[model samples]
Target: MISKSTIDQVYETARLEEVIGDFVQLKKSGANFKGLSPFTDERTPSFMVSPVKQIWKDFSSGKGGNVVAFLMEHEHFTYPEAIKYLAKKYNIEVEETQRTDEQKQEANERESMYLVSEFARDHFQHNLWESELGKAIGLSYFKERGFEEETIRSFGLGYCLDHWDDFTKAALEAGYQLNYLEKTGLTIIKEGAAEGESNRKFDRFKGRVMFPIHSMSGRVLGFGGRILGNNKKAAKYLNSPESEIYHKSKVLYGIYFAKKAIAKEDNCFLVEGYTDVIQFYQRGIQNVVSSSGTALTPEQIRLINRLTKNITVLFDGDAAGLRASLRGVDLILEQGMNVKICTFPEGEDPDSFAKNNSLEELQHYLQENSKDFIQFKASLLAEESANDPIKRADTIRDIVNSISKIPDTIKREVYIQECAQIMNISEQVLFNTLAQIGQKALSDAGKKAREAQKAFEVVKSEPVQEKIDLQYELERKIIEVLLLYGNEEEEFEDLLLRENEAGDLVLEPESMAAKVYEKIFLDLQEDEIELTHEKFRTIYYLLISSLSENEDFSINTFLTDLDRELVEEVSSILMEEERYTLHQWERKDIYPKEKQAGVSQLVSETILTLRCYLIKKRIHSLQQNTEGSSEDHRETLEEIMNYLQLNTLLNKKLNRVLS
Candidate 1:
């Protein structure tokens, strides 16, 4: 468990915008920050962060809370893990108690796998630095690759011993479970034993140097290991098998280190392999990541999309590799991102080129060599189709198909013009080809939609519109008012029921001065009312007690003590109108009334509405009871009449006309 003092300090020191900004790119909007929803696939900005309130809301997914909550949702960190991450980010010392054996065993399966992966990472790093065989093999290989010690350590590069069960044995001895070890693909198990014999186990990355693959928040999800010796029987690069924690297609190498730089530069340098990413980053190019030797995936592209709209793919001069990577450029275009391609000299790849050139030379080479995707594709294809009319025509259609993948019409048209100029083809011809491809794509999409509809046609019906829950809404409003203005002192117009000279019931108005929370509490208590919703009820009492007790209360500090569910609830209620506020209505010549200006009236109206609703409910219940009652029917009728009259008087005082 983390000490409360440390957690408090972390909450105080860590800024919500700064923490979430590491994962999602945030742009300033009015008094807050808005960004594309990291929790959802969105083209528009709906994720909001309020630094003043220290809470965030994602309107797209409807997830909202404070800094710690964002980490838990985005990074999948446990509460303690989130606090530790914040502590590490802000350079605060975390005070935690040592977990007992039972506590350690209490972790869930996914967390257990994470713990095992983390342990394996540390064990491998220790082997690389301290073990004799590791220093002679893994350390020597990294050194020969021109990776400095600091770079190696920063990326958490390590080594696994050559012996089959060396890593497996070490992990077992360190109190790590073999089940998790096997699940994480650290220890591969083969079952081919007789009744008395045990299943065989061996290290998955034996005789290899380790490169830890991390999530965007820097958790060790898996690893990419490269074999050292000439092993013609084995693959050169091996990755951890798919587990609950690691999916290769969704994982990018060096993203944790590159996210900030990518967002800062507003561009990302995408490469092919782990070494390519490491070499470029070591040479002071920080905004770079790799697909880890796999073909580029849409998932990986979306990862980079979260940070920037520009991707410059770095390729070596191998002809086959260059052709294979052109498909990724289309994928980037489909995502509405700008893409450029840069190739090294004919004999070099990114790793070798960066090793040979100084930082200035490497940076200058990229600047001079990078070409827009369309220009590069046109020139490359134009050469391939030289003096062959059929091939040239096919190439034109191919380029147009790629252009058709772009979502932006203006960009597609601009690229079409550029293509015409480069290939000496008619712009009209290219546009016609683009239209055909787009039409076919739409036709295919329509077919799929119709097929899907047919599948659900048997049970499909019009979606039922849910009726509004008035009582729940009133209860929610009361909580919102308390959260917003509970501590505020305001003069209120108090109403009392009295008998007039004409012997009729009337609402006699009076003046009273009290805190907003005090007036609300007294009104609710007088009516014997309680909130119907469980969450609102809990928060109501919490707010009433806290606001009444503390003269200097803060929502930020108060929220720190609640669990994530309640925190999300409170944030949703508090920021319900944030979207409107973000629009700056006054600037559009639409002056909206401010909530703060009418705090007293808002409180009184909310309580009066609740009272009216409860009275109507009571009257309905009493009328139902009198319908079938055998005894005391007249008494029940009188009670119902009295409640109806009181409800009418309350509504009239609230200026609500009865139908």
Candidate 2:
């Protein structure tokens, strides 16, 4: 655990602009900086960073936060990872609280599993280089696959020894718990052991070359291993079992390495195996990831969706492989992403094809051969159906089903037209089929919604609270004043309403001066008024307490203690007026007044308006209570009249005409 003081130091040392600039190209725009959003592809600059408030907002995606949040969102760093990154950047020595063995043991199960899996990756890599059997067998196998030493190392390729307990023993000797090893499927414990005998545990991937699967942020989540020898009884490839930290359906094999390239190229080359991903990467085609031969899943497609909307699936020319992976195309379409299909020459997989060609030749071939998903599907399925009318009818319906998965109407129509041209079917027929599929989908969705509605009973909504917009607006304005000009002292003329000796109320302008915080606090205290909204009251209390404790208050320092949501709201409030770069009014023959010129009046008027709004609400409440015929009904009527008089006076002071 990082010490609180160290976390504070990191937050203080890291500047929002400087931190976000490392990943985003920002140009100075007035008091803030503007840049293209890193979250999505857009030509316009909508991402804004404010140095004064120490926050950033990506207008395009509605993501905004302090410095630490940007790293977490963009780099996918965890809280500790984000903090450590900042500490390293600012050259701050992090101080950690020393934990006992009991505390260490209390670490969460998922984190422990991650730690164990990472250890396994490192252990296997070490074995590949240092163990005699690993080098002679596993290293030789990778080398024969045309994987260079650097490529093998980059992907964390390694070897597990043939002996059942070799790796498991090494892990136990290294002080790692066997429980985690078993949970990660790195070690398999034999079931149904004989009496008086300890349950036998063996390595899960012994005598296999390893491929470490990483999360988007490059943390080792799991592993895939290929057996070196063709043992007729054993599976050729094996994967880690689903664990707390490893969900096979949710992970793609090489996403960590391919994310940036996918974003840069505006497309991704999705293959099916670890070797295919590695070989393509080695051949300078870095934007490629593999599903590790599993059926394509929606979760995997969403992983690609984060980087780009375009996916080009490379298929082996073999008919069986093509047929097996065809379902994935529909999954991609359902995600609202553009998908293209490319088939290699006969008998060549992506791995073999890339290995045999130069980088230039491979790039050109992919560019020239890739076809729109619908076109490719129709052409391929048409050939397979081949003059069989009933098979061809099924083929058209299959294509229509895939088309129905597309969310865009225009794209579906375009696909239908293309299919009609290729299959010699009417566009109207395809459109009608698509409409029926869509209608059925909507009906199923409606049924699910109804079922869910029944399962979760709908609660009655609470009565609407009557909102006083004027009061709410004034409350927000008061907070804005304190956040912007609280420390500044200025002179202002406040109206004094009094009964002169002439027996009539007279208004007099009285000169007064004080710090904004002092003026606002005294005014609210004298009026006995509190901000009605819970969020506003919380902000007000914190602001007053903070200002009282420190003679000189720093908004940036104050923000470090706030949660991300509050920090964003406060920063947004402070920086709202500065969203568009400050304009040079003088150049346009108009002189603009500085905020300091009106600070005293603004602060004074904001407090006065809030007090006036509160007085009116009190008067209205007392009048309503008088109708209840309580024992104090006459007293309530009197209070209402008194409040009404005060409300009138306050309205006069605010320069509003009586209705």
Candidate 3:
């Protein structure tokens, strides 16, 4: 359990822009910062972070919240986890309450696995520094490879002892479960031995250097192990097999460290090995990640898209696997990501070049060498053809095919033109290829859409009953006013438009928000009634608190001071509105209506008061409908009578005010 005071400190100390800016590239726009949606693919920026309110709203996905809530939503951190993340980011010390034994036992299975993985990482790291064998084998191995001690620690490198069962036995002894061990592919559970008398525990990676693969949020989902001995019997490297937490196809290694750099560079440098990523970062080219030598998948591409749109893939120049990896560029194009390919000089890969040169030199070489995938492919194919007519023609079509994978219309046309010039082919030929591919893509999309609709027909076709209760329409209206224009000054008709004693009409300065809320409060108390909707009840409670607070009306401050759940509700109400605070129509320099200022204020006041009155009427009706038997109906009758009198008075006041 976390203390409320600690949570408040974390929230108060964590700046919205500072926290999000570490992960997202936000450029200022008016009072907010806008960036591409991390949750969806869009060229135009719809993710807005408002510094004044200290909240963010993604117009595309409709997720909006304060900093802690954003972490919970964006990175999938739990409430406490998010607090800890913020605390670490801002250097705040955490003081968590001790958990009960039962509460510890009741933690979710996934969370337990996460804890075990974290423990394993720490144990390996500690061993790497403490044990003689680990220091000699693992630490020395990293040092020989030119990795600094800090780099090794940063990447969580370690080694497992040669003896089987060492890691498994230790983990199990530490109160971790064997079931999760086997599930996470850290233990080999055999079926034939001893009729299931322990199934024999053993370490997955023995006599091997460890490289723990992490998620973007730095959770140790799994690990990749590299063998140290000359074991022709064992593979050179092995990774944690797919499990409940780790999916190789979806997880890109080094994204945890590289995400901020990727967004800043506006390019993801995709390498082929784990060492390639580490070496590049150590050399200060931090905007690099490895495919882990696996064929690139669309899921991995989408992960990159969350951070940036441009990806530059770096491959070994002398490697035999170039042909196998060329397919990734097309996949990148299909996702609408701009991709370029940089093939290093012969006998020099990213790891080698980075180790040999300074960061600036290596970065300059890469920048000068990188070519758009289309151009690189065309040039490579051209050289391979050596002007052989048939191969040359095939090369042209292959380049065209790569261009065809691009999704944007303007970009496709431009690439087609570029290809025509490079290959000396007609633009029409390339455009024809692109049109064919584009039409096929559209047909495929339509087919998938139809299939999805069929699969979800029950849900999609179900009738959507109107959520608005007719009796409570005015209640919601009042809520809308409080949510939107509650702080605006307006004229309140004293006694609801009644003439003054001097035979003249006059208006009074009464806060429409306070007056209507007070009326609703009084009416509810008189009938001993309650708001049906929990969210509505929360909003009503907050409104009462706002009234209870001293004057200096501040919608922003009131909202910022709310609890997380109600903050979300309030933000949804406040931000969904498309208001032109510019007030362009109000300025006389442009155009103005007669007495628009006072009339507008008066009209807003009437709307709010009327809404409160109607909500009160609905409450009365609900009270009447919810009455028990007429036999013991004295209190019920009294409630009905009192509600009717309140409703009639509110109605009269509302009509007079509106008129």
Candidate 4:
């Protein structure tokens, strides 16, 4: 557990712009920094970072929070992990409270697996550096591959000694439970023990060079190992088996290292192997990652979709491998990303190609040779279908199917036109095929939705009534004003509307000055009203207490004291306006009203409307009671009539026409 003082210091030291800028490409927009959302795929920017408020909002996804919360949301970091990351980034020493044995045992299973994987990574790294056999074999292999000594260390490349029991014994000696080690796929425990014999335990990556696969936040999730010696019985590369914390299909190699570059370059280079990513990265191509030889999954594509919508896939020159990987292009397109295929010359892969050429030559070749998915697919398939009309027809359909996966109508139309020109087909034929595909897709979707609705209806038999709660929105608005302008003293005016002797409504402006929070608090209390919503009520009390105690308002301080959910709620309120860029109505010869110009009237009207709602509810309750109990009927009727008159007058003051 981190101490409160340490958390506060860390929050105060970490700058919001600097922290988010590491993961996003933010350009200045007015006083704030704006960029495409890292949470969703979009071309126009909807993510905003406010330096003065020390918060960020992704209007596309409705996610907003301070720096720590952003890390937690974007990288899936736990609270302590996020704080530790910030502290490390800003070079602040962290102080944590000592935990008891019970607290230590309370860690969940996934975290335990992470701890075990981390321990294994450190143990293997130690072996690579300090052990004679590891140095002679694992270190020799990496150096022979032209990997720099610094690169080897930074990527957490390591070695496991050939002796079967070496890593397993060290892990046990260090008090790590065998169960966790086995669960992480670091140590394999054989089943069906002989009589009077302990179950066999051995290292999974023995006699291999290790590469630690990390999550987006840089936590070690698993390891991929390359065999160092001739072991025909074993596979050349062995990866950690599926565990609680490691899913190969969902994890992309080197995302932790390449995310920043991908965002900056606005393009990601996708390769096939781990070394391909490392080699490209070492040669100054930083925006690259590998699928670790697994078939690409939608989850992995969505991972890349977070940083940018442009992917340039680097394929090996080998025809077999290239053909097998071409399907990934459609998957990328289906996720609303633009994918281009870049194939090296025969007998060269990304690793060899990057190593053989200068960085400039490699980059120029990539820029000049990369082809869009439609062009690449047609050209690649055309060579095999020459003079075979049937094969050519099938090839055109395949291209059309890929185009149909694209969600953007304009992009789809453009691709279809390009495909028609390349394949020497009529545009009408392509259009008919596209329409058929789209109609089938819609029919399938409708069928699935109907089935889902039927299942939901069977499980939920009762009708649920939802109330139109006006007070909740009004209460939230009041909190919004308090948080945004609480300490700023400003002039406020209310419009006094009344019927003059000439029987016409006249508006009179009355002005006064007060701190924003003071006026809001006094007005609500004067009307004998309190916030009714539970979350708003809690926030209201906290705000008042903090103001009275400190005599100042700090958004950062207020957020630090809030729980995670409350932090999200408060940030949502503060960032709601930034969700859409403000339009310049005046530019088009139209001047719209500004909320800032009439803050006093807005606050007064909000309070008055709330009071009117309360009075109407009271009158309704009195009428219901009067029908059941006639003993106090006259009193109830008199009270209800007076309440109605007051409600009517309040509505009149609000300039609301009577219905």
Candidate 5:
């Protein structure tokens, strides 16, 4: 268990915007920050973060909480892991009690795999720096590639021994499980020949250099190993197999290091191999990542999309390789990103180019040589289809197809014009092709929709509309008022029932000054009314207790002690009205009332509305009881009449007419 003081320190030191901003690019909007929903595939910004409250909400997914909750949701971290991450980020020392063997073993499969992978990374690095064979072969290989010691260490480059079972033995001796080792693809286990024989284990990356693949938040997900020797049958580069924690298509190499720089530069430099990414960063270009030699994936693109809308794909001089990589540009375009392509000269890749040139030269080359996708694609294709009318027509259609992938109509049109000039074709021809492709895509989508509809044909009922729960809403409003203005002192009008001189029972209004929470708590207690919603009831009691006990209570600090569900509830209640701020209502000359200006009135109305609702419910129950009971009904009827009069009087005080 982590010490409570450390947890409190983390909550105080970790800024919500700064923590979430590492993963999602956030822009200032009003008093808060808005960004594309990291939880959902969205083009519009709906994820909001309020630094004042230290809470965040994803309107698309309905997930909201404080900083720790965001980490748990986005990074899939355990509670302790999230706190540790924050502690590390904020440079705070974590004071945690040691766990027992059983407690350590109780970690889930995914977490165990992560642990194994991290251990493997450490073991490999130790081999590179400490072991004799590692220093000669692994360390030598990195140095020969012009990677300095710091560069090698920063990327966690390491070497695996030639002996097949050396790593497996070390892991087993360290009390790490062979199950997780094999699951993470660090160790390969084979069954023995005989029943009594033990299973044999081998290091999967034996005789290789290791590169640890990390998640965006810097957890070691897996490894990519490059073979050292020129073995005829062995694959030159190998990656950790798909496991519970590592998915290559979704993971981008160097993202953990490059995320902040990518956001800062407003552009990501895309390369092919691990060395390419490392070399560029070593050359002082920090906003670069690699695809790890895999074909670009939509998931990878979305990862970059979170940081910036611009991507510059760096390619080698190999003609075939360059042509093969063009497909990734279309993927970037489909995600509504601007893509520029840059290629090194013949016999040079990003790794060699960065290694040879100074930082200024490399940066200058990229700026001067990077070409827009339209110009690059059209020029590359025009050379192949020179004086060939049929191939030219196909090339025109191909360019239009790539343009169609762009989501912005203006960008698509602009690219079409550029393609017309490059390919010497009419702009109309490209637009017509674009329209035809779009129509076909729509037709195919419609067909899929109709086929999906066929599966539900037996269910002919219309979707049920949910009726508004007035009591629940009123209860929610009461909680909201208490959370917002609980400690605020205000004058309130108290309604007392008295007999008039004319012999009629009437409401006598009197004035009293009390805190908002005091007024709400007293009003609810006087009526003996409790919130019906379980969540609301629990939070109500907590709020009341907290308000009464602490003279210096803060919602942010109070939220730290609650579980994720309760924290989410409180955040939703507090941020419910913040949605209206996103619309910039004042900019349209439409001024809305501020809740803070009328906290006193808001409290009184919420309590009065709850009283009226409860009274009406009681009257209804009494009326129903009188209908079927054979017992005396006069008392019930009179009780209903009295409740009805009280309900009417409360509603009138609220300026609500009761029918």
Candidate 6:
């Protein structure tokens, strides 16, 4: 419902690099930014972001699109949601047309859950700030923990009322559905078995201080609650049960606040608790997030890896916790992330230490304390071994094994040297251990891959393949021509589509893309059915509207609008891997040439030329296929003449280019 101007503002303001740079650490790769793929598990970066095109393509996952499209695909934002996100990012005021009550009432269960969670957060905040009990108990607790009012508001922290059913009553009176409240785990619903009432709803986090868990894009996913009241049998901290909108394993606390800083710093600090992250950020270290309580997952590490190659694990100095957390460092390394370990002094956690120091002082301490994972591990292990050769040797091998997980071949070599320096072992011995573990892992992976491939073959079979008719080739070519040469002016002797469509087709046919599409659709209308190829048909219709409906005729825009599979195929065709022209341009000292113009222009032109050629070839083929069906000489002669004329026109255009 956003106004046209608002939508344009969102799209225009969304700089591709700026938007993507919030999540991925991008280094300039030619004119584009290249970084590790966010879509897949990969070490070497094949993802490319083009500022000029206002789009990005992940060669690994084959997902390519404009900035809004990227957010939609990567972050799962709906189209309007994506535009609003961009608008918010750029701090632009948005103007959206109001939806009707019926429209608003049609909220899906997932969106409804999110709505209820957001309301619960607001209710808690109001209590924290306005109510006496909340200020005395809940708000005081956060302050006692050293949280500033701004930090509390920024994190959306709040207090659930100590009275049971207080939240439940307010939400129901506000016309919010009780079903959504229960579904979101904000309220507990019990169906009547022996009770007089059919249903009962009560606040799930009553008497608790709230931590609103957020997705990277800052959407409220669920809540984590810390009990404020003394209940002897109750646990101190509890999280909302898993719901459709909240998956604990996939969600990380503080990511919403930390993502931008993480990208800016080109590193992420992994800590263990909500306060740990809040304290670090409060201490001017903004690029920090906590696993919240889950054992370190590859998924969690991969989330960090998307932003940066380097990660620093901040652990408490407890010997048991430090040892347990070291295993998480291995997970980071396996994702090709460089890791360092920093443990605070015994009896002191990040929250206390940071509160006691200024930002600069805290940063200085971090810089001095941070040690390369290999060095830290060796030192810690050596102290534990105490000259026991077997344990020492085992520690060396374990360090080597961690080193082997680095997917970058060059990095593996560098880490091997570090391993030698720290453990005081021969580089050859460490290298030998790395190779042994790496080879075994790869062999095991290969065996599993082969087994999966065989299983896939047994379960699935090839569909009845559609033979590529000449028309299919022609249709594709026409689309290509329209996209590339649509804006160009051409002096044409035969503007056949325009002439024939003097009545029904009122199109001005401003661009080559439009003209070609109009001509083909007009010509094809005589056929009994539309294109048999479902994907092709969709593209065909889309291309027609691309020209007939809009004036800008942006190929990148069109590519973004298409379905994902078609978008990938079209983008790969458009973004040819033959980057020789780009390399050659670099040698010419073009000095920061604009991105995608040269590449996309060339692609668009090639498709047009191919299409014009194929259209004539298709008419000839079709004439031949239908020739024997009609024995009448006059009808046959007329068809032959039409085919010849189209051929002559096509050949002339082809010859001009090919020559």
Best by TM-score: 5
Candidate 2, position 454, lDDT: 93
TM-score of each: 0.94, 0.80, 0.81, 0.88, 0.96, 0.81
Off by over 4 Å in 5: 456-458, 582-593, 628-632
Find the 10 residues in a row with the least total lDDT in model 1. Answer: 591-600
Q: Give the per-residue lDDT of model 6 (tens digit) for 13-98.
A: 67889888877778886567788788898776778877765667787777876777688777877777788888988998989777
Clashing pairs in 3: none
Task: Give, for candidate 3, the lowest lDDT window spanning 10 residues.
Answer: 577-586
Clashes of each: 0, 0, 0, 0, 0, 5
Candidate 3 Cα misplacement greater than 4 A, ranges: 41-44, 97-104, 443-493, 497-534, 546-567, 578-609, 612-659
What does candidate 2's lDDT look like per residue over 1-659, in tens digits? 88888988987788988777655556788678887677765546678888987878777776777787788777666677788779987899989866454553566676678768888999999999998988999999999999999999999999999998988998888667889899999999997568788888999998889999998767798999998787989999999999887889988999888877887787999998999999999999999999988899987887777567799999997878687688999989987889999999989999999999999999999999999988899889999899899999999999999999888889988989999999999999888998899889899999999999999789899899987689777888888888878888889777777888986666678999888888898878877887887777888888988887878787866766667667666766666655444344557887644466488878777877777777777777777666747475777777777667767777787788888
For 1-659, candidate 4 gives per-residue lDDT tens digits of: 78787788898899999888776778777678888687886656788888988988888787888998899888777788899899888888889876544553466777677877887899999988888888888888888887888888889999989889888899788667788889999999987567877788999998889999998778899999998677799999999999988999989999989989998898999998889988888888989999998999988987787677799999888888676788888889898889999999999999999888989999999999999988999999998798899999989988999999998999999999999999999999999999998999999999999998888655646788988788788888888878877777777664455777986556566887987777778777877787888888998889877766666668888987788778888888887765544333457877654366466666777777888889988999988887756485787788988787677777888889778
Per-candidate local distance difference test: 0.90, 0.83, 0.75, 0.85, 0.90, 0.76
Per-residue lDDT tens digits of candidate 5, residues 486-584?
888899989899989997779998999998889999988988997899999999999999999877777877787788889888888888777776667
Sort the candidates on TM-score, descending order.
Answer: 5, 1, 4, 6, 3, 2
Error of 6 at 92 (Å): 2.6
Query: Could you list the CA RMSD of all candidates, in the order they appear?
Result: 2.6, 6.1, 6.4, 4.3, 1.9, 6.5
Candidate 6 stretches with Cα past 4 Å from truth are 97-104, 193-199, 230-232, 446-474, 490-659
| TM accuracy, model 5 | 0.96
- Candidate 6 — which pairs collide? 477-611, 481-608, 482-513, 486-511, 486-512
Give the lDDT of residue 354 in candidate 2: 98
Off by over 4 Å in 1: 100-102, 192-194, 459-465, 581-596, 619-649, 656-659
What would the C-alpha RMSD of candidate 3 be, to one decimal place?
A: 6.4
By summed lDDT, the worst window of 10 consecutive residues in model 6 runs over: 505-514
Give the per-residue lDDT digits (tens) of candidate 3, residues 417-523: 88899888899877887778678889999999999888865544767786856435445545655544444444444334344698644333344433444554554
